[model samples]
Every structure is written in C-alpha cells, then in structure tokens.
Target chain A: MSDMHIDDFKHEALDHIHHHLKTYVSVFVALMALTVVTVLASYLKLSLTATIILALIIASIKGTLVACYFMHLISEKKTIYLVLILSVLFIAGLPLLTLLAKYDVPVN
Target chain B: MDIPYTVQPRPDTGLYNAKVGIWLFLASEVMLFGALFSTYILLRVGAIDWPEGVDVLNVPLGTLNTLVLITSSITMVMAWAGCVMKDFKRFRFFMGLTILLACVFLVVKSFEYGSKFSHHIYPKEGAFYAIYFTMTGLHAFHVICGIVVNAYLWGPGAKLWKKNPAQFTNRVEVAGLFWHFVDLVWIFLFPVLYLL
Candidate 1:
C-alpha cells in the first residue's frame, strides 16, 4: 500500500512538471515575438532616448521571463530573493558611482 | 561527518547548501556585468560620433544565437524534469542537446568575432569595438564556463546519479539555474549591444 502511495506521489510530481512544459513553450513563443519587436524597433528611426527606453524595457521583460521560469526563481525561497536583493542594490550603486565620477565633482 | 546539507535543505535557509551557494555566485555575476553595462552607457553618451551598432553588428546571427540559447534553456529544464520522472534516458537526451546548443552558440559567436578581426577591426579601432569586444567577449567566457560545467555533468558526473539520485538531480537543477542565468544575460546583451 505504501509503495502504491509513493508511486502516485511520483506520478503527480512529474505530472506537475509536465504541465509546466506548456508554460515553457508559450514563454519561448513570447520571447521570439519580443525579439522580432526589438529588431523592428531599432529600424523605426525613433528618437535615441525613445529607442533606448524601448529596447531596455523589452530586454527587462525578457530577462524577467528567463529568470522567473527558466531559472526557477518564481518558486525560490526567501533566502535566494534576499541574495538577489543585495545584488540589485549593489548593481544600482555601480551606475551611481559612474555618475558621481562623471558629473558630481566638487568645485575646487 | 558527512556534509550537512549536500542533498537536504538546511532548516534556516529552506534550500540545499549548493542552491544558496550558486545564487550567491550569480548575485556577484550580476554586479560584474552591471559595471560593464554602466561603462558602455558612459562611453556611448560621452562619445561624439557613436557607431551605429545595428549597422556594424550582424543582427541575423545574433538573433539565431538568441533562439539557440532559448531552446537550450527549455531543454535544460526538461532534462531536470526527466530526472524527476525517473527517466534517465530522457535526461541524457535533453542534456546532450543542451551541450550541443551551447557549442553552436560559441561557434556562431566566434564566427562573428573572427570576421571582425579578419577585417582588421580590433578593439583598439574605436570606443564601439572596445565595449563590444569587452562585453561580448566576457559573455562568451561565461558561455565557455557553462559548456565546461555542463559537459562535466553529462560525462563522469553522470555516475553520481546512480550513487545518489536526489543529490544528482539537485546538482542538475543548480546547473540549470546557472545555465538559465547565462541565457538571461544574453537576453539583455542581445538588444543592448546589437540592436541599440
């Protein structure tokens, strides 16, 4: 009886992952669509600022999809998120450092 | 005594030791790439006549590599799923495909880089080539690292599966996370470098 229960549990777990296959396929399709859009946006002859914004926004979305699903961050624990938060904070600081060095020089 | 959380979740962290370790490693990777990205921005904004990246880069090739990496991500997850399902054959097939796709990406990338060098376009040519080579070359290094790790998992590391199935599967999952992170970096790099 216990063996039967273990078999069922394994089956259910595998089935859950099998269902995620569809999510993966759909995400792939969305990513491809976004890629096409990214290339097209480049040729749209928009303002430099607009183009940069659009490209980055699209890239951010793609990055999120890969991180959440492909990297399994969607179901990750609090500890992993904590680590990422720290990383994001430091990364955010990097640009600030550059900006400081570039334009924030104190008057002599 | 054996390792405390080799195959089991630590109580405080609610994750295996390796999972936490890889994530921490990935965190540092983010900062490394982030600094380079900031440099790219400063270089572009400060330069007088920035090169038209789209004109210089082969978009079709970059697109192909993006597709290839995305496909490998799916196969990688499927490989782990196969392990979960107790299907070693399926795992091997998908793992093999992931490694093959990684090799293809590197080959295509090298082709792109080689053509530039053959044209005598070195990183010293301009700020554009400097940032381009630095960013993509670093990314290519990550791809090489992924290939080495994945290759190990595919070869002798496969023995671990028979020794301890749970630990083996966890190792695959951790590796998948790294592989996916690599793909994530490319998703950003594709547009920022090539399209922008």
Candidate 2:
C-alpha cells in the first residue's frame, strides 16, 4: 500500500514539472515573437520618441515574462516579492531624479 | 556543519535560504544596472547630435545575440525543471545547452566589438560608444560569471545530486534565477543599445 502511495506521489511531481516545462517553452516563443516585433518596429523609421516608447514597451513585456515565468517570480513568496518591489521602487526613482536634475539645471 | 534551510523552506519565510540570498543579490544588481541606464539617458539627452543606435551599432548582430540569450534562458529554466523532475540526464543536457548558447552570445558580441575596434570606434570615440562599451562590457562580464557557475553545476558540482538530490535541485534553481536575470538585462539592453 505504501509503495502504491509513493508511486502516486512521484507521478504527481512529474506532472507538475511537465506543466512548468510547457510554460517555459511557451514563454520562449512569446519572447522570440516580441524580439521580431522589436526589430521590425525599428525598421519602421518612426520618430525618435515613438521608437523609444515602442521599444521600451516591448522590452518591458519581455522582461516581465522572464521575471515572472523563467525566474519563477510568479509563484514566489512574499519575502521575495518584498525585496523585488523595494528594488524596483529605487530603480524607478533613479530615472526620475536623473530627469529632474537634467531639467533643473541653471539657465546660462 | 549542515546548513539549515538549505533544502527545506524556512517556517516563517516560506523559502529556502539560498532563494532569499539570490534575490537579495539580484536586487543589488538591479541598482547597479539602473545607475548605468540613468547615465546613458543623461548622456543621450545632453548631446547635441547623438547617433542612432542602429546606425552606430550592428543591429543584426545585436538581434542575433538577443535571440541567443533568450534561448539560453529557456534552456536554463528547463534545466531547473529537469532537476525537479529528478531526471539527471535531462538536467545535464539542458544545462550544457545553456552554457553553449551563452558562449555563442559572447562570440557574437566579441565579433561586434572587434569590428568596432577595426574601424577605430571605441569607448574613447564618444559618449555613445563610451556608455555602450561600459554597459555591455559589464553585462558580458556577468555572462561569463553565469557560465562559470553553470558549468560548475553541470560538471563536478553535480556530484551533490547523489548525496542530496533536493539540495542539488535547489542549487540549480538558484543558478537559473541568476541566469534568467542576466537574460532579462539583455532583453532591455538589446533595444536600448541596438534598436533605439
């Protein structure tokens, strides 16, 4: 009876691993498709502002996918999320402070 | 002494010790890369006439390198899954592929750098090349670190799988998280430095 139960548990673990593998492959495909879009968007010869916005958007999506799925952040615990969110807040602050300082320069 | 919470999750934190440690390290890395990105922005805005990345850098090579990194990321995650599934052969295969893809990225990147140098284009050339080499150089260094870690895990370090499979798997997951972070950085770097 115990042997049967152990076998069942092993099968269940394998199933879960297989599920995660499928998700990993799917994310890979999405990332490649986004890469193609990014290159094509560049070739569109859009204005600098438009190109920056579009490229950043695509990159953000790709980054999020890698973070959430590939890095397993989606299923991570509160402690990990806490650390990540804190760092993100700081990183977000960096560009804001940079831009503010850039524009606040003294007029010659 | 055997480490506490190496394989098992901590009661309060609900995560293994190394998991938390890697995330903390990655957070610091986020700040490191973030500052460099800010510098890039500052230089671009202050320049009177900044060259387009597509014009200055090899976009095709950059794009190819991006794909290579992405593929490596997938192999990395799959290797972690292999560990979870208790398939040592699968783990080794995917891990080996991840390292190979990383090498391909470095080779392509070296070619890009070599071409630039042949044309007398370098960090000393201007702000664009300066930030480009600084950011990508740092990133390539990280890639090399990833390769070293992964290769160790794939080769001799894998002996842990016999004595403690769970611990070995956790090690792979930790390494995979770092590898994925490297790939994530490239995802952003590709467009910012090459396309945009």
Candidate 3:
C-alpha cells in the first residue's frame, strides 16, 4: 500500500508539472501580446482615464504571469498559496484605500 | 510503539528543494519591491505640479543600457544551461560574458548618473529629480551587487563549479532569476521615467 501511494503521488506531481508548463507558455505569449497593445495604446491620443485603465490592466496581466511562472506559485503547496493570496490582497487593497482616503472630504 | 523493520518510503513531491527555496526567496523580494513601487505611485499621484521636464534624461543612453542588461539575462541563462549539460568550458565562457555585459551596463549607468550630478540635478532640485535619483540609484546598487556575486561564483573563491556541478548550476539559475527580475523592473521604469 505504501509503495502504491508513492507511485500515485509521483504520477500526480508529474502531471501537475506538465500542466503548469503548458499554461505558463500560454500566459507568457499573452503577456507579450498585452505589452505590444500597451505600447500601441500609448501612441494614440486616448483620454487620461482610458489610458490609465488600459495600462493598469496590462500591468496586472504581466504581474500575474511573473507571480505564477517565475515565482512558481502555480506549483506551490496550499500553505504557500495562502501566503501569496494574502499578500496580493493586501497589496491591491492598500492602493484603493489610500486613494479613497485622499479624495475624502467634508461636505456641508 | 515498536519500531517497524520495513524501510520507510520517501514521498515524491516532484519539486527539488533548491527550486522551492528560490521561489520562496523571490516571493519575499516581490513584497520588498512592491512597497517601493506603491510609494512611487502614491507620491506621483499626490504631487500638485507633477514634476515636469524629466525628459532631460538621455533616452539613447538608457536604451543602450536596457539592451545590455537584456543581453546579460540571455547569457546568464545560457551559462545555467551549459552547467546543466556538464559543459564546463561553455559554462565558464558564458558566465564570463554575463559578467562582462553586466559591467558594461554599470559603466553606461554611471555615465548617465554622472551627467545628472555634473548638472547639479540633485534631490534638492525638485520632486522629479528626487524620485529619479532614488529609483535609479537603488537599481544601480542592485546591479553592482549582482556583478560582485557573479564574480565570486565564477572566480576561484567558491569553485563549486568544479567540485559539485549540480549545485553550481542551481546557484547560477537562482542568480539568473534575480538578474531577470532586475531587468523586468527596468523595463517598466524605462518607459515611465524616460519615454513618458
């Protein structure tokens, strides 16, 4: 039974690694496409809001690719994944919170 | 409980220990730079005048440095691959080239920084100069550290490349990952600080 469990685990791990490799390639290609679009967007005379929004979207995609592939978060254990998720949540929320606080004012 | 005579089976986690360790280290680094980037954004947004005239930065020089750094990344990866293939001669050659490329990058960066300093474009000039100097200064420091570390690994100091080639490959791979991260950060900074 113990030997069987070990074999099963090995198979599962290899499968996981293979699946992640495929996904990583796709994400990397997507990131390159987004980068090109972002550069093209800059040349056009888009409004400030539109430009900022597009840039942020592209940045998010790039960040996701790095976090998942280069950092190996996609293949990490559950505990590690939890830590990553918490960090992202804190990082993303802090900017929004700061922006809202800055714009808040007393109204008559 | 009586000890069992049967040999315990080792679990197959698939990931090697070094790979996992490198990823954990990278995660911490991400947080470190994340805070710096957040501060940059906050300051840029809160500024009233938006610190105009930063276009004084030499775009051609910056572009050249970008290419040099990117080429270094490629060479570093090639060095790692050479070690994996047990080609010590090629590994050393590529590592030497990587170090040379990194030095070229630093020389160009120093020229850029020197020109700014000669013009008295210190932090006291304005907020734009303040942010500009701080960011680039920090990046230059990282490049210096990377070069020093690469030299130690490829030089006679450690000599792990000769003793244990696999461990040497791991070291080179981790260093390559960090170097790539540095290049990635500059890719964003180049457009924002120079082109934009």
Fnat for every candidate = 0.72, 0.81, 0.05
Order of all candidates by DockQ, from best down to worst?
A: 2, 1, 3
Q: Between candidates 1 and 3, name the one with more favorable TM-score.
A: 1
Q: What's the distance in Å from true for residue A23, model 1?
A: 1.4
- DockQ, every prediction: 0.56, 0.57, 0.14
| Clash counts for the predictions, in order | 0, 0, 0
lDDT of 2 by residue, B1-196 (tens): 9899887789989988999999999999999999999899889988998988998888989999999999999999888888777788999999999999999999999999999999988899999999999999999999999999999999999998877777788899899999999999999999999987
Ranking by lDDT: 2, 1, 3
**Which parts of model 3 have CA positions greater than 4 angstroms off?**
A1-84, A103-108, B1-18, B52-54
Across A17-61, the per-residue lDDT of candidate 2 in tens digits comes to 877878888999999999999999999999989999999999999
In CAPRI terms, where does candidate 1 land? medium
Q: Which ten residues in a row have the lowest lDDT in candidate 1 chain A?
A: A1-10
Instruction: Please state the Cα-based DockQ of model 2 relative to the true two-chain complex.
Output: 0.57
What is the per-residue lDDT of model 3 for residues B69-165, given as tens digits with 9 covering 90 to 100? 6567657766665665556787788789989998998899889888988988787787777777888778888788888878877887347655545
DockQ for model 3?
Answer: 0.14
**Estimated TM-score for each candidate:** 0.94, 0.94, 0.72
- Comparing 1 and 2 on lDDT, the stronger one: 2
